[model samples]
Target: MDRPALLAALRARVGRLERAGAAAALARSQAGVVHLSEDIDAHLPQGGLARAGLHEVLAAEPGAAAGFAAVILGRTGGPVLWIGPDPDAWPSGLVRYGLSPAELVLVRAPRPADGLWAMEEALRCAAVGGALLALSDIDLTAARRLQLAAEAGGALGLLLRPDTEEAGPSAALTRWRVDALAGSGGSAHSLGDPRWQLDLLRGRGSTPRSWTVAWRTTTDRLETEGGTLAAPTRNRRRA
Candidate 1:
């Protein structure tokens, strides 16, 4: 082959090798667990929520209950199945959080037990990307079963309960107590107000953390505050 042609062939071969090496490195980087980070890293374990299998959030009040579930479902970005005690009154804010109204499948059960069962089935469906199950109350056994189903389907599960239901054993990967805080509106840079404060209660391989997050319904974004709570505290007595 001509000298110029030989040199060109050699350069192309070197470029291909370099690209292959880069791809290999990228694959290795992604092989491990990947947590989702939405601007607030310090408040979360490793700067993101663990995306491994199952996670739970328990709210201390009705507002917090609905808002926390919405935040978790919003982050999944997949088809969500919400099973509630009553079909008539579904949490409207969930739709505002970017969960498509069409993407959400609401199943209303006459009783809390039936609702839990329906939620388990929904999470088991491969077609379902994620699920948020809101119950008036769920016993420890029911929670454990739901957790198992979530793990099997590789779907994220959130159990929203009243403050009274917080006492019990749970199979959830993590339990978060969420509260709605008064928020101020102004320039975007300043941490306007405390929209929601989340307290992580339990998780394997990770310590608890607290976060101050703002939910902008119009923008469909959850902005993490520049600051987090001073210490992790559990209001189990109240819940």
Candidate 2:
């Protein structure tokens, strides 16, 4: 099949699956494992965020966002399959966040569509403890399908996209906007500093907030102050 046709088919299948009762059952069965960071709790107001099921983290850029998401999944301490077309150059810093490079299964695809397909197949595999699928671009329909698949598999699905694309409504259970922050180390802090500023754009059963978090590179820890940035009371609806 042609690329467009194949993607359309995948989207249709994923949509049907997401609406099926099995998806909700899968999410419920997989709901107990989410462990939110102290900083995340402060911003969330709800003590902690949901861990199981599919959540979306939207970012203005791919680097910081993908790294931040990696840090979250790294804590699961399970085999992770990182799927992308450019797997050879997968970020090395993921190791610093507690993910053992040896435990990662890298799947390389030739195109964005192929990468999506590979991600679906990998997440469907029960042997995989968790999976992180990085995409350069995706539409609303495709994103919804991925969210469903992650829900069914009980895995964390992180979608990394440009800031321009994230300015809209999505089917993800939670949405996060992350940006770089000043490193905690002295003025000499360089590329690997374990600190970040994350904004919780949207979440279920909670308000939107922002956090100045210290993301430890060595221990894969996320810490933040005891306050949160209140979400705007009124704003334009995302597309």
Candidate 3:
């Protein structure tokens, strides 16, 4: 081979090796956990949320659940994919949750099957940081597929569903119920920061717990009253 040709081939081979090394490192994390925040990390068995796993969020109110999911993804550090039957893509509200609409990709799938398909495909993309699906219901098989896809891509997967007294089991690593809480402010007329009651109904190797928290826009941090990552205000037994 000519000198230039050999050099070019060596460069190409080096590039492939670098990519492989990155994938290997990510695969290790896929098999482990991701440190989300100090508040909730210690409570989890893996010391954090599973990096490449599906998590279910039962929405006491759709808006609150959606907000919480966005907050989680904002810390994930990459482009986010949001899929739903019908999505209200309001840019203004997303900024408060720390997601830039410019970096968010929204997919609308009117049919349930289509939405599920989109979610799986998005989750399997290596470049995507996170994927959120506002699903009405998810079965075990479908949930497992999502879990596998997340592992393949090393991305966070979130399923947002309506809260119910009886929610069927799924392949999700954790299940959280988010309820909107009344905001506090100096005056009743002035709007306060958003607040929510977060209930960790179930998580692999973790007991059920709850927290009442608020997002402070001034500091751009979500914290309990004492400026902690998460303060457990209550604990509940699984039904």
Candidate 4:
């Protein structure tokens, strides 16, 4: 083989080896960490939510996505800093979801830039257990900043983006798309547990997967079995 061709081949081989080494290292690191619940933990590469990482949550239905995030925040036992415009959470409603209104500090930013700033600052606060932000648009640079801040404080950062926004490149540790199911509610008069079709679109050192989960807000419990809708039966007219 020519000298130049031999050198190029060697470089390509080195590059491939480097990529494989990085993937293996990431997998080893993730296997030791487990966050959230058993169902989600089993699917995630990191086992559970990484305490010092950023997680992105998006859904076509805004309410469904918000509920999913709420469940995560509920698992944290410290104060939660929520930043956004016109948060949809009701003080009483949060109780059913395992969040205490007293433990929440809400910050309403007049603009998107201000909101992002608040989120980064909140995530950096050691006293804060988690930071939640509602954003319609975000770039790679901004997302990385949030991730770093969360790592510094060992807090979980949840970014809620609009479904209309495309799932482009992000520095977030995990990206999830939550869709609310029709059977989320119970009877005509009373609302029962909320259910969702949770899609894990992206994760570090993990494959994408989906699940149907039921959340009993009153008890803050997640049930994975017997929540799915039954197949519809086709009726045929008698001849």
Error of 1 at 221 (Å): 2.9
The models' CA-based lDDT, in order, is 0.60, 0.61, 0.74, 0.70
Give TM per candidate: 0.71, 0.74, 0.80, 0.77
Cα lDDT tens digits, model 2, 18-43, are 45535443553455455558656644
Across 1-239, the per-residue lDDT of candidate 4 in tens digits comes to: 34355346534543453454454434433333425557777766656787767999886578778777877776665567677876666656666667788767666665787788778866765556677998887899999999999878666889988765356788999888777776555676766688777767778887666677888765668777543223212231110
The model with the greatest TM-score is 3
Better structure of 1 and 2 per TM-score: 2
Candidate achieving the largest lDDT: 3
For model 1, how does the per-residue alpha-carbon lDDT over 1-239 read when each residue is reduced to its tens digit?
44355346534543443454454323423432233335444445555654425566666656755765665665554556676766532545456655667556666565676677667765654445567777656667877788778666556677776556435666777777777776656556664433777777776666666777777766666676776555465444532
Query: Candidate 4 — what's its lDDT?
Result: 0.70
Candidate 2: worst 10 consecutive residues by lDDT? 230-239
Judging by lDDT, tell me the better candidate of 3 and 4: 3
Ranking by lDDT: 3, 4, 2, 1
* Candidate 3, 1-239: lDDT as tens digits: 44355346534543453464455435545546655456767778888777678999998887888888888777666667788878765657878988788658777777788778778876776656678898778889999999999988777899988887667887999999888888867478976888888878788888877777787767667765544433345443332
**Which regions in candidate 3 have their CA more than 4 angstroms from the true location?**
1-37, 226-239
Q: Note the residue pairs that clash in candidate 2.
A: 34-51
Compute the lDDT of residue 173 as modeled in candidate 3.
Answer: 92
